[model samples]
Target: MSQFPPPLRQPEAERNPLPVPRPMSGRKVLLAVLAGLVLGWMIGMFMESIVANTPNDIDPDELHRLRWLLAAAGALSGLAIESIRQLQAASTDPAYRRRRRFRP
Candidate 1:
């Protein structure tokens, strides 16, 4: 008996993997954006409710300003999250050659 059985080769479909440089799927991107929006909205709503329930000693004008500030901050955070996702995708893209070509 041969010590080793005949090599079992995988089918061509299995040997070579699918396409490379896979871009971010639309479904995944949409889900990520939706999650970010929902989370930001929930946080904004929570802060607003807290400010509304605070004692009368709090300044009403300040509360209004706080809402604007929070809104901007939330938007920035969402953008940051999306940026990170894009960066990760770019890093894995096969077409993203690490070697740079210099032009005089």
Candidate 2:
């Protein structure tokens, strides 16, 4: 008796292909932005606290300003990073290359 059965090959239609990148949904986009904002806020608070003159703490007024400024900056950077990533993914796709090459 054979220890194992012969291996079976998958059909072309059933074979797995490389995953294609898709655009983020509205909810996913929101989550990405929110994650960036929170990350920036954390970093900003840490840096600000580190540089503070009195007892290593930031002033309340400065903290208020940092919240908005850092969050906005982070959101912009996050969106930009996502765009670059998407572009890279599209560039690597065969269909995208063909379409670009034969554009009218």
- The candidate that wins on lDDT is 2
Q: Estimate the TM-score for candidate 2.
A: 0.50
For residue 43, give model 2's deviation from the true position in Å: 1.2
Each candidate: RMSD to true structure?
9.0, 9.8
- Model 2, 1-99: lDDT tens per residue? 899999999988568565666664556556667888888888777766766746755567877688678878888777777766566665546665444
lDDT of each residue in 1-104, candidate 1, tens digit only? 89988999899978975345456566655566566666666676787788778775677677667666666666666666776676665574545544678999
Model 1 residue runs over 4 Å out of place are 1-42, 92-104
